[model samples]
Target: MPSTNCTTIYKLVQRAEDDDIEDVGNQLFGDGSSTMSVLEKKKRFEELYGVVRPDAIHAHPPNVVKCKGSGSRLPSKVEAAKKAAVKPPRRCGKCHKMVNHDSRNCDKERSKKQK
Candidate 1:
């Protein structure tokens, strides 16, 4: 079975060319899976490197905080959250399933039986 460290190891391989590659790799492998908790990793890297990582790591919405709600409020909150969660929608023009995901993400409505 492949270890969870596979990803960190793969990254070590990919980033081997960078100046800080050795330091990052050492941090990752030194801690078992080298999978630092997201917050810890972010904090550590920002402290050490003096730069923020990419949007993939930091894209959580600022105004969003989770709390319990019920009934109409829950649905309304969900709809509003969805609106706040907007990314450019990736619906396929042909089938309209979020084809941006993978072929499996192809929309059922969009997938027609071709004769």
Candidate 2:
């Protein structure tokens, strides 16, 4: 072995600027010989292919909260509480009745002319 450290190999691949020195096949995957040391293989794989990690593996940062639900993410605690806390029905000042509509829009007065 002629001192093929990761940095040296990486530099060679990166510093190639000539037309004859086109980049290695981006789509190519390398399977270094089983006999090779784990570290050596990883370095060789990186030099021939791309970076240490594939692009797809790191396109998006990992989420802190893992969702085990059916595809859809579970709602946060705050959101769930908001949904669960139902607002009490408003009181109608006109009739002292607790209902949806307020006094201004109260339908309690049977005849409008009576008001």
Q: Global lDDT of each model?
A: 0.63, 0.63
Q: Please provide the root mean square deviation of candidate 1 (C-alpha atoms, Å).
A: 22.6
Error of 1 at 66 (Å): 44
Top-TM-score candidate index: 1
Candidate 1: segments with Cα more than 4 A from true spot:
1-20, 28-34, 51-115
Give the Å shift of residue 22 in candidate 1. Answer: 2.2
lDDT of 2 at 92: 86
Q: lDDT by residue for model 1 over 1-115, one digit each (tens)?
A: 3776898888887777674766676664454664667788677767677888777665665897556564353457778778756756575655556534334545543355442
RMSD per prediction, one decimal?
22.6, 15.7
> Would you give me the overall lDDT of model 2?
0.63
